[model samples]
Target chain A: MELYHRIQIQDVVRLDHAALDAVEAGFRALGQGRVVQPPILSMAIEESNGEVDVKTAHIRGHDRFAIKVSPGFFDNPSLGLPSLNGLMIVFSAKTGLVEAVLFDEGYLTDIRTALAGAIAAKHLSRHDSRRATVIGAGVQAELQIAALKLVRDIDTVDVWARDTDRANAYAERIRERFEGLTVNVHGDMASACREADVIITTTPSKSPLLDAGHLPAGVHVTAMGSDSPEKRELEVSVMTCADVFVADTRAQSESNGELKAWAGKTMPFEVQELGPVIASGQSPRTGHDQITVCDLTGTGVQDTAIASFALKRLVA
Target chain B: MELYHRIQIQDVVRLDHAALDAVEAGFRALGQGRVVQPPILSMAIEESNGEVDVKTAHIRGHDRFAIKVSPGFFDNPSLGLPSLNGLMIVFSAKTGLVEAVLFDEGYLTDIRTALAGAIAAKHLSRHDSRRATVIGAGVQAELQIAALKLVRDIDTVDVWARDTDRANAYAERIRERFEGLTVNVHGDMASACREADVIITTTPSKSPLLDAGHLPAGVHVTAMGSDSPEKRELEVSVMTCADVFVADTRAQSESNGELKAWAGKTMPFEVQELGPVIASGQSPRTGHDQITVCDLTGTGVQDTAIASFALKRLVA
Candidate 1:
């Protein structure tokens, strides 16, 4: 009997970095127009213990199912378990066979999201961008730094979290990890945004985190926090000031973020999509002074593409 | 990497008698109200060569993906490939883990379907049923014979097909396989149904094959074909004589078959669902002189339940 291979969750955890690289390739594939990601459907399970979020993403061309399970895995530091855990199944489009099973839970998610920010920086951030300001010193914040360094030659990074000690620890870790990159611990959000070329907001705040008054004209902001309707990370005025705005999925981002906040108001710029422009080589990187904002609403297509790519790697 | 167990298609070939037994167990599980199967969503892809069907079944308690792919692998009669070929995947519900993958495909489908007929026979057929007639001399006909024998003591089985040779071959095979089970090759459809205690139809016919007047009193007919709205195997008059009618899914059978044949017209009896009856232990066997009919428009729940069962077997 010939043995058929089964890829497991442990495989996903061990090879998350490689999966991240594969996801970058997936983004490039999306840019090359080989992606069909539908808006994710989030189902909330109200449990007595706590609320569990089931995030489902369907990727058509890749024929994959990526469902994310989030129960605030990181918030409870005593639990010693990551707050997010999920599995992905990549199916064969030719036969509808579930080719491989991946249990990244949230590792691949963080990687893919951080990659999206990097991709956004590649097309939206200035060419000579050196300074970085990341709001929220969490797991995602760490990933953002790692992903940004790959796409930009950043020399200085300002780390700011609600907890001062955690923020300083994150800054010290960043400086230690990347020897040449200077890291600063900012006391407030306003000061962090003042001298940064690229500002990333990943906080789970209802109100604005970064003041629009502190942001310079040419700074490109990648907002990654506002996934749910109530979670807003950037001020409405910041969206108004950006020269060009892009979103992973316009319908999803609008429904979740800027549109949810400014329900009755009209924005200056229409939310352009990332797929067509990236695929058509018509990105918003015309000049260094373009103030672009990319709202990263996580998509299933990326999950499918990444899972498919990784399955091929596992098989090959 | 440690190698897991390997089950090849060849290793499981000739699963006939044993497979039928497994199918009986599955049906009993259904009868015992232990299995929960949801409705299936099937997508038919018609190609110039032939057609392919992709059916997906979702088991609630079992987090496995069961997909049935029926390609036209048997159309080339010269090549001698059987018409149906596919596989099933059983995943672990607890960990969302894919535990085992089986290549039984059509073998399992045939057994389970035939077991459904046997189940119908136990509840719908007369206690003194002695004669059985099965339309369609294909593999499913053999399954019908196998499953019927398990439920009834003595039976003279009549076989009918498009080709006399095929029908005769099937009759000869049944006789040789079942030993004491008497088998007869019928030249015409009407003669096959005449005085038959149980009638099982498995042909992929677009029109009805059995006439209502041909069936004897107390006959229980298992309509195995006409899963889709475009396909049906029993005449409208067949329902007129049916004392009590049952369907796998009411919505599916109503839109498709004798139900549709009598659409907008008043019917003698409302079709009871097999699931509810099995669940509630209320399967009514009218009487020795009352005709009964079970219209099966196969549901996804069966697949899910079966797959879940198979996964449990693999685990054990």
Candidate 2:
């Protein structure tokens, strides 16, 4: 007889700094070549306007690993339901017995993705970075800024969205949460990114929204959206102008992220991975005058890491 | 908020003929090209002697689909644990929200795999088939024979295993459950298969155990054991000698089943899929003197079908 536990979304929403640290360690492990992360298995259900992706990774020597089933039904919002929902199945690596199912309903994905943005900024941004600009005013737009505050002393935020009302509402939400922090709604992408020390793109845009001319010198950018082949956020020139161009994984970047703009051509600059950057103590930014860009298409290591972390918290 | 239900292994063991019919319908749907099943996602944990495979499929017009996590840790039996363990996570096709989690401990897999063997025999074997021979006296060996009775009036059974005592024990168990059926334990594979009208192979052997010479004319063979690249139960000549060759899926058979013996080469006969054959009502064996071989590598449609069926039963 085996025992199986169910950890729900409410239980997962209480994730703290420890959960972020666990995800960071997963990246470090991957960078050190101690993780076996396979290519994602994706299937589209055209009839229901939905798609499902299965991701899993094993961190060497870990007691447990996780296989996450992430499904996105784009039409769910019309049915009075959330668009994204799924869970993580965690198993004991030693015996292959299922330990728990984290029915987080995509909450863990949101947490880990936000944490990845923070991890990128911790290594790439300058210590004095304060001002931030966020493209898109969705759940990720708000979460990315909140996550960034973990590493940088973010005091002011500029938000740009195609919908002005949503952008203003996003600003108001941020203002209520962070006391003394100034939030501004920008009408254009260029104006929003002009004076920012860090810029985060969190849109599901099908075309490039930010180009090389939009970036201020020394500003670090984290493109958190564009996780599918048909979506891209940064222009190709934006990548060419950056001093450091990092990806969560090179293969994913080529097929699903901003690097898809490269069109199978070799990049002019050396490409770095977030895992290696975190594992090694080397900062790609040597001076305050160099631009940096991080492309996050997401990875399986983050899912397993966050799931393992959530299960420990729930059980404890 | 979304609700998730956990249906345990004990709850799943109550599968009956209706559940088997549900799985059979799944195969029919796949055969008719109404299912969208993606390639399997497999990851190996070599250090722990375990491997995990994720399988899912969306059957057209169905309200829900299933993503099954199957992990096999060969060393678990020594630890007083079953070597196979995992569950199926079912989601609503319209919203992609998790409908339920069936922590069935691989009971559903067993039920479906056993039904698949019976399905093949029903479509390919002679209607008057009354004698059955099973190679390897394992759980599947017993289940396959029991499931076969749903299709044929099996009155006698011959079983062969590496260990004769285990074979005798299997015979006794069958005798107790299936009253009026004569069961025999055979020491040699050839003798066990000689006088049988239906032959089912259920072993984890890494080499060929049955050849063309062992298969008598007019006998229908259901090779259910070889589901990995390293395992092969039927010799290539056995396939060549068959009047018709059917696979659960051509792609899986080429990689993991006895069809791997063909080594990327085309077979002399047209290879049919079991689903289409069932859907079309086409019997590959017209006369009682022709041999038919059905290779069972398992499929995602079966998992989704059985999971959906089990959920309906549990909820009701």
Candidate 3:
């Protein structure tokens, strides 16, 4: 029966340390087999060049669970509208009654997604990681860097985009946000990845945008763009060449992430998941020179976790 | 968003002719390939013995579409709570923006489900059908009869339930509701179905409850229960014995309805969908003695159609 708007939700929940811990706990619970998440339900409106996805999950002991309705209208920008917007409904896990509806317009998804990227870096990236590179000049690019600051000592940042002007704009925004941090716009992706201790791919590209040659030694990559079957950011070799590869969930990675490229083929490496890695308290990085990559197709557990956290903050 | 509760929604949308027409038009649009519906998104909370399903569809030209979240906590009734309840979110098809939040607590689902049964009867049943035998003495049994009265002259009724006391109570309620209508409580399934012009199965029975021998000659059977994979009402022989079998949607029927029992086996007859039957302007009932059966595994299109209809009524 409670309703919170986008501004109210944004005021209460942020990509801060507490939020990161909450999201990490969700992954830990998922790894411990205490989370019940089902495959996402997505519908396409071809007439409007739109897609809407519904995702929900219940963590065993949470007082409430969340069902997120996400709508992405690709063609809406032509009419001067935001491309992505939707809300989340949280219900009591006990009585299955509505507790709150967060009309966040996708803000919480952005926060939780950024936190997942940072969580991957925290567990997979080199401990002293300082330089980070982000592909895609969208809101997530900025949010990812902000979240990474909580997990790693990321001081210098590199920006890469299909559009050079957007990349420069992204660098300018990052420079203004972080007081003494260094931000540079890279004209080419290869130069951007040259010194990156952590690389985050956040684009909506439909084809491979990152190559095996682009990743430097000891660099960790987090690809969060390809949450749908049609999108991919890492080339097949980029994932295969890494010393370790982890997915948010193996099923989604095979269907909607970089691993879909290797659909019928058996992977040469033992693919792990972020949750299990977090749960085991073992870093995927064995040595300073080991390269790691994490694929995030997103999960319902993240939605439920973030929404529950938001509700707690709102009620407080 | 505009918010309406169960009472206001029930006051606006009923088992009336106009509501049925709106739902039928949705099926027509679906049959004509103008509907965009995705497979349901379902999640189970085993700890609470609960299940949640998210269903949605966009009928191409409609101004608005609907996403319905239905939750069933089978264990809730032990604590004096209703076993099924949830809400629907209606959005603009053009802008993908939320227009209303319908806190109908599953009333809309009931109304639409009942109307779908009546719609099937209108298209597939005999024109002079005057009797309905409902297999379960639950809320749906009463709603199905109320909706069936809109299309067929269902004056005589037979009530059958595993619980005899509940069946007797259902018969009493029916007698009181329909003036001068004969209502009888049958002790067994076959005896109740013997004189039925139309038989509606509306139970949550996991195993087969209705047998092939239970159906009388030329009877049109609408099986509305068994929406989940674990539930089935009619024996496999009951479906195979029908001259023609119709489903709300073939995919749902095969996966979640009676057809899952025949998973790999080839069917003896062509299985058609109710939407296509409604669209083709043809009845599968070729002869007066032809037995017809419909598997009513509720569909996303019906939810979208009914929610859209309810939204209009509420706003008016």
**What are the models' TM-scores?**
0.67, 0.96, 0.97
> Candidate 1 lDDT, tens digit per residue, A1-316?
1222323533543324465556555555555655444343332222212222333333334433333333333343455544455445444443433345454555566767887788788778897899999999887788888888887899999878999998988888887888998888888888888888999988878887765786876899999988777778777777777788888777777777654666755666677776655666666767667688888867655665565655565566
Q: Across residues B186-305, which tens digit of lDDT does each residue of candidate 2 receive?
A: 889989998999999999999999999999889999999999888999988889999999999999999988888878988777899999999998787898989999999889999999
- Ranked by lDDT from best down, the candidates are 3, 2, 1
Clashes of each: 5, 0, 0
Ordering by DockQ: 2, 3, 1
Question: Which digits, one per residue and each the tens of the lDDT, describe model 1 over residues B51-142?
Answer: 33334443333344354434333244544545554555443333333345565646556656777777778777887888898899887788
Q: Could you tell me which residue pairs clash in candidate 1?
A: A73-A83, A74-A83, A86-A105, B37-B301, B38-B301
Leading candidate by lDDT: 3
| CA deviation > 4 Å runs, candidate 1 | A1-179, A182-273, A284-304, A311-316, B1-111, B163-165, B203-217, B224-245, B250-271, B284-292, B295-297
User: Chain B TM per candidate, please?
Assistant: 0.83, 0.96, 0.99
TM-score of chain A of each: 0.85, 0.96, 0.99
Candidate 3: RMSD to truth: 1.5
Stretch of 10 with least lDDT, candidate 3 chain B: B261-270
lDDT over C-alpha atoms for residue A12 of model 2: 48
lDDT of 3 by residue, A161-280 (tens): 999999989989989999999998888999999999999999999999999999899999999999998999999889889999999999999999999998758988889999999999
User: Which residue pairs come into collision in candidate 3?
Assistant: none
